[model samples]
Target: MKTLDFWFDTVSPYAYLAFERLPQALEGISYSVRYRPLLFGALLKHWGQLGPAEFEPKRAWTLRQVHWQARELGVELALPAQHPFNPLALQRLALACGDVDGLPNRRVVEALFHHVWRGGGADASDPARLQALQAELRPALDPQGGEVKQRLRALTEEAIALGLFGVPTIAFEGKLFWGLDALPMLRAAMLGDAWFDGPWNEVARPQPGVRRR
Candidate 1:
């Protein structure tokens, strides 16, 4: 069976949106999904780029776009009080949930995404909240333990080595499909469809308000 590696951060609204829709969207597809939780802030720092929330215009547009996209997907979306909350413990909690192939673990990940994005629980960095979530998610494994912390760091490093620059990246057979917009393209690729041969060309049009030299 083919596997699709999905890297995501709980802090990313786009990731939340994608996660909510993927199970249903991929209903007919013959592929196994593997969710890899990683720290998006670390990736951003390594890439020397500012996140969408770093700029006012981008942040405003992103917030609006997420809501619009959620409506389009028929999924309810609510923004957290903090745009970019710390997701270290959350990532570790995801690891503690065990294999992504299991329904319980997948559900826990989905629940966490909903808690942050739809539930408006905000402040994932808070130890109390993280602990509560970890317990509620998977009490058997210790998310705050040293082993899980190391495992989370290792996963982040592995993602960096895999050329993952952003969350919600879908990888299969050494090819990567980035962002929610790329989901269709990834599906096409899986079906052996050449949907992205080249960029579309456009003809230039005359401007009515331009002054002649």
Candidate 2:
């Protein structure tokens, strides 16, 4: 079976949106999905490439763009006051849960995303807060929902070894699709056997003629 390797961090809001929709997008497609969790911020540091919103101008533009895109896509999102929070533990937990059938741990991931963007879950750095979150959801913070901490840790380390440095990176048949905007392309690739052979198969090609302004 074709495999869709999904790489993401728990704190990534866009990743959250994608996670909520991907399975439906892949329903008719022939493929197996795999999750590879990693540290979002840490990965960026290793590549010398900062995130999309590191600058003032970009940040301002991004907020507007995010709002516009969210409206069009029907997913609401905003940078919460509690942003840049530590999502290491959450990612570890997600990595573990990624393997279980039906992704039972997705509820927690979805909840964390909503908690961060929809409300005040952004300030959830305190361990007690996570514990409380756990008590409210699954029993004792893991594995009950098919959550696996140890494997997630290994997967994060594996991602580091694979030279990965971004959240929402999907590797299909050795091709990597990074970022949310790439989701459509990913869906197209996923649904088609000619994913690597289509006329517009420029996903991995070099377009030197297309100049960047």
Candidate 3:
């Protein structure tokens, strides 16, 4: 079976949508997904770019777009009380639920996503709600421990090393498919479509005519 590394950050509404739609997108494919939760803020800092929510106009556009996309895709999504909230706690908790190889429990992943995306405008970073989630998870590792924190850092570093600048990216066969819209392309690649062997590589060969300062 093929293994796909799914990199996500709960702070992203698109990631939540992708997580919910992934199973249906990959139907009939023999593949296993390894959920890798990382801090979206860290990625933004590392790449020297601001997140959509950090930019005023883009934030508004992103909010509207995600809600519209969710409706079109028939997936449930509700923005939390705050955008760009701290996701460190959730990421650590997800790591604590992992096995020895650090493969997080899919159920726990889903629960965390629901906490953020389906909380009906509740504060995802609220201490009480987080504690409740921790109690519900009964994680194998200590979510508040140093080891979990280090592991989260390691994972974020690994993602950066792999050249990932965004959440909801699926890494398959050394190629990265980014965004919820790329699911169809991922499916095509998984099915070994020959178009990837031709235009996929050829398309990247074009250089930009104008440089932005």
| C-alpha lDDT score of every prediction, in listed order | 0.77, 0.65, 0.93
Q: Which predicted model would earn the best TM-score?
A: 3
* Residue 179's lDDT in candidate 3: 97
Q: Candidate 2: where are CA atoms >4 Å away?
A: 30-32, 95-104, 120-122, 126-128, 139-153, 193-195, 198-213
Q: Give per-candidate clash totals.
A: 0, 0, 0
- Looking at model 3, which ten-residue stretch has the lowest summed lDDT? 99-108
lDDT of 3 by residue, 36-56 (tens): 999989899998889999989
Using lDDT, give the best candidate's number: 3
RMSD of 1: 6.6
Candidate 3 lDDT for residue 7? 97
The C-alpha TM-scores of every prediction are 0.84, 0.72, 0.96
**For model 2, how does the per-residue alpha-carbon lDDT over 106-194 read when each residue is reduced to its tens digit?**
56667666655665434655677666665555543354233455555566677777767787888886667777778778877766647
- 1 or 2, which is superior by TM-score? 1
The CA-based lDDT of model 1 is what? 0.77
Candidate 1 per-residue C-alpha lDDT over 24-83 given as tens digits, one digit per residue, 9 for 90 to 100: 766677887778888888889888888887799999999999889999999988888777
